[model samples]
Target chain A: MNNRMILAAVAAALVAAAAPAAQAKDWTHVKVGIEGAFPPWNALDPQGNLTGLDVDLIKDLCTRAKVECDLQAGEWSAMIPSLNAGKFDLIMTLGINEKRKQVVDFTVPYASGVASFIVEKDGPLAKMPMTGEKLDLNDKEKADPVMKSIGEMLSGKAVGVVQSTSHEQLITAYFGKDVTLRTYKNSGERDLDLKAGRIDAGFDSGVYGATLPSKPGNEDLTIVGPQLKGAMLATEVAIGMRKGETELKEKLDAAIKSAAADGVIKTLSVKWSKLDLTPTF
Target chain B: MDFPFLYETFLTLIAALPLTLQLAATAIAFGAILALGLALCRISGILPLDWFARLYIFIFRGSPLLVQIFLIYYGLGQFREVRHSMFWFILRDPYWCAVIALMLNTAAYAAEIIRGGLLSVPHGQVEAARSCGMSPFMVFRRITLPLAVRQALPAYSNEMISMVKATSLASIITIMEVTGVAAKLISETFRAIEVFVVAGFIYLAINFVLTRLVAFVEYRLSPHMRQPAPLSAATVAGEIR
Candidate 1:
């Protein structure tokens, strides 16, 4: 009897010690939201599956952090609100900007890109000087001349841009009353309008603009204006979380930092965007 | 309460009101004519005409307005034949595409309303008119048309107000109306609630004025139903004495 009691106490102690270890190995499943509409960063493939640089990077980051991730696609306008409402744990491919930072916490940037204009190959504005120049919109002196020339060239012409993007802001602020600004909900619609000759020009990311001319049936389209960066057009794109989610934000930041250092982001960027968009930091 | 910001946003949104009103006005005007024609076809007693009218109404009424707008704007543009055709000129512009979609959608609902009105015209009245030696055209002009229009006015007014609100969907296809400008403002300020509030008030004001105008027209058209003015207190007292 005495021997049996001693054995039973030892077994209970062993079981208690192993229970916590089992719990520690349990994975934390995170629900991630992504706008699978923007190409090269995030977009739906021909099979209706999410495939892009952001998708690849997020999967890698989640794997490295050992967190089980459930990725879902959402509309761009509803992303931040849904994140705040606890619909998702994090939003991938969010462009870091001052206005957005006021509402959500951001991880370290994973990629950066510039914005530009796409126009018909033989369009009126296509002949404008500064076809491939990189203009820093933050510099008024340098940006003003480009703005003046673009304004004169595009006056009374209809320009299409995605709504709620820096592209719309840039056109509205610079062109003002000189041009008719049409705002679309997504890039695909704007691209359609551009191809159909409904709009004289369309504004989008330089990476996307560069890819358009090469697309089958898009031979008439070409990047016509300067590659715009800085100012309202944010350079860095990162994952966004609801404010006060320090633990998740920290984990995401670390994962992104490691991914950048290990060249994972660079590999994905080159594969998707045909350029290295790995942020320096 | 951020009155200044609201005022500023209101001013910005107001600038786009003309586009909204223009879309609504154009769609409503064209839709009314199409509705009348469809209603006539439905009542014409011809099998093919009635079937065509039924199919047109079913397709437009069954689908969502947004889908209709997208199909006309984006989906139609996808076909090479559409792009190369003469209709491309009209289909190419987002504004016209939106108007065409809205007009078609509204016409479907309006045709049903007008059809109900036409049916509601008393058969006895038509028989009486025919017995009195009135010609078919004369009877239709003097009796059927007037009574049908009056019967349809109340429902038609509701459709008109809805058409005004539907104009906001045009923004999805890149037409900058009041809602489009509000969306742009929200994007810039990141104050979605405030910008939308101002936009709501602008729409309310427009609809309020429109409602009153519709009510006045309804009152004017139904003069035979108006009641005599009530007696004043002095007149009542004098009558009692």
Candidate 2:
């Protein structure tokens, strides 16, 4: 406790100390941060090098933007705080949402994907109604009945969610009263519990929906429930930066647009996640 | 400094304080019994018991508490039989899992403290008690235990304070203790600084009371350590100094 307190205090001090150093930027060198754990987005390889869709996408974006970028891997929790504290200039594979926009700015979304639940292949929720279907949460006329049925299916059952993700918020808002929530620090931990039957199902990215079931140890898992987007569930992925960095935001936004126009995002998304996540926007 | 938000955060955190205190109290209480058992085992002179206690201490003490927590919570679930066992009811709840982890971790550290206190019992004191026709158990009960506690009080106080702080780690397991609530608040609001400040203050306040309570206990145990009562200017009779 003492150590963390002192470190937070020291970080605040460093932010203050580095304030003057932020006078003006030439935009030649940019420091980018990634979790390096979220597979298909950004992750470390066996050789301890960063690789994944976000890694590849960032490289192309930086090249088009004509900025030299340095990539660093860190814990997910530290990404935003470190960015706000000036430790990193940009964070990759960030999901854009209103709650997050209050604290940081985001470039135009470069990729998009739906979120859904994963259950044991033989579990009661394995073939829930609306499975293999997609629903826009904003389209309440079509979504309401499906969501109500899904909620009924989840009632009294514990569902696992990764902490701080939009999925956590969505589940809480939609089924907070009916379902028991078990928040995890990461999807992998949540998966372990789900496989163990400690949780009835797990809510996560479509990448997990697409990739996790085929992974070695997760063979029994199957994606269930409707693919959900819009509203609290942020499907659009963007590069997060400290709020008010207009110059950097403009440069990155333009780069992201260029990359999307070139099919780079769609190509890399397939290479990493095998899902074409290029956003229509 | 958003005073209103800080105050609101305080209310939210304070509401969760009982859980934080409950975890600490439960851990400290049960851990004390476990610690006493291990300490006895360590000093009981039976080789197997001593080695068993030593091994228990070595493992729990050596590994990080977070790993132990994950092991007990997530690791144990990996075994199908354990999940199906009758004890699964107890092991299934995250609350109990956290309690079990906290209790075991504290016991390891407290065991050493208890052992040190027990070993600090002077040979002459035990010898005197034996010469006074007291049975070994009586000697330990009336003399050795009391003196050991007094000797161990200062160091033991530090352990108790740390155990209070250690309860914060239970947040990771989703216990919604003070730290847990603060974390969720930060994640939702993205206001890390205010939430952390509030949470830290909650912990600080708890430990402050804990230290004062421990100090009071120490004072009561050490009547001899107090300064002699000041001489009264108003004398009674002739026997006054």
Candidate whose TM-score is highest = 2
Name the 10 consecutive residues with the lowest summed lDDT in model 2 chain B.
B232-241
lDDT of 1 by residue, A1-281 (tens): 69967777776676456422211223389899988988877889788789888888889999888798999988776677677667887898777777788878898888887888898888777886677888888898998888798899899998888776667777888899999988777887788888887888998888887776776888888898787888777667878887766777777788888988999988999998888888877
C-alpha TM-score for every candidate: 0.84, 0.90
- Misplaced by over 4 Å in model 2 are A1-24, B128-134, B224-241
Q: List, for all models, the DockQ compared with the true complex.
A: 0.30, 0.32
**Reference contact recovery of candidate 2:** 0.59
The per-candidate count of clashes, in order, stands at 0, 0
- Lowest lDDT sum, 10 consecutive residues, model 1 chain A, at A18-27
